[model samples]
Target: MARKIIKTNPNLIELIGNLKDKSYNEEVAIWKDVASRLEKSTRRRTEINLSDINRVSEEEQTIIVPGKVLANGNLDHKVTVAALNFSKTAQEKIEEAGGEGISISEIIEKNPKGSNIKIVE
Candidate 1:
């Protein structure tokens, strides 16, 4: 028997490829985990909210979301967030709270070793 592969969006395929390359080049397992999650079926992909991140994260923490970050609530403190996609309101809210919202690729380039990072979804 062979394992079945799930097809994902083209953009997601590129993201996953980059993540796998970064994981191998940097020897970081977290990147691989993030890549794998992004490879899931679109319906199965991770989708998180600011409130959920607030629940699981601490102030000034670095967090990553493999799918999308939605602006459904408030952020209590400053934090850095990286995600494949962020809602317009989410980006605004993050910055308004003195936090930063960045693309996952940018975060990967800056932190290849994936240190002190929490996967929000």
Candidate 2:
């Protein structure tokens, strides 16, 4: 019998590998959890919206979206958003509202300890 492996995007594979490595080195549970979620297929992956971020996040929070972020609503306060992908409009909206849109790997490199980070899927 052979074990089946889930097929995933190349980018996601790299990202997941990095996340697992980071988790081992840093021993943080969040990184591992995020990687697990990201391992899912594109269809099942997270798809977060700006409105959801605005509703659930607080000022100066660092939020992670495991999937692409859609631009649908307004953001009242500035928050750091880390995601796999972001729509052009969503990126603009985030930047316009004094927030920053960064990739997951970028955020991981910046915050190895994963402090003050919230996964908003």
Give the TM-scores of the predictions, in the order they appear: 0.91, 0.93
lDDT values for all models: 0.90, 0.93
In candidate 1, residue 82 scores what lDDT? 96
- Leading candidate by lDDT: 2
Which lDDT value does model 2 have at 60?
95
lDDT of 1 by residue, 26-65 (tens): 8989999999888777778788999998888888999999
Model 2 ranges off by over 4 Å: 1-5
lDDT of prediction 2:
0.93
Query: Which pairs clash in the backbone of model 2?
Result: none
Tell me the tens digit of each residue's lDDT in model 2 across 1-121: 9555585568888999999999999999999999988877667888888999999999999999988999999899999999999999999999999999999999999999999999998
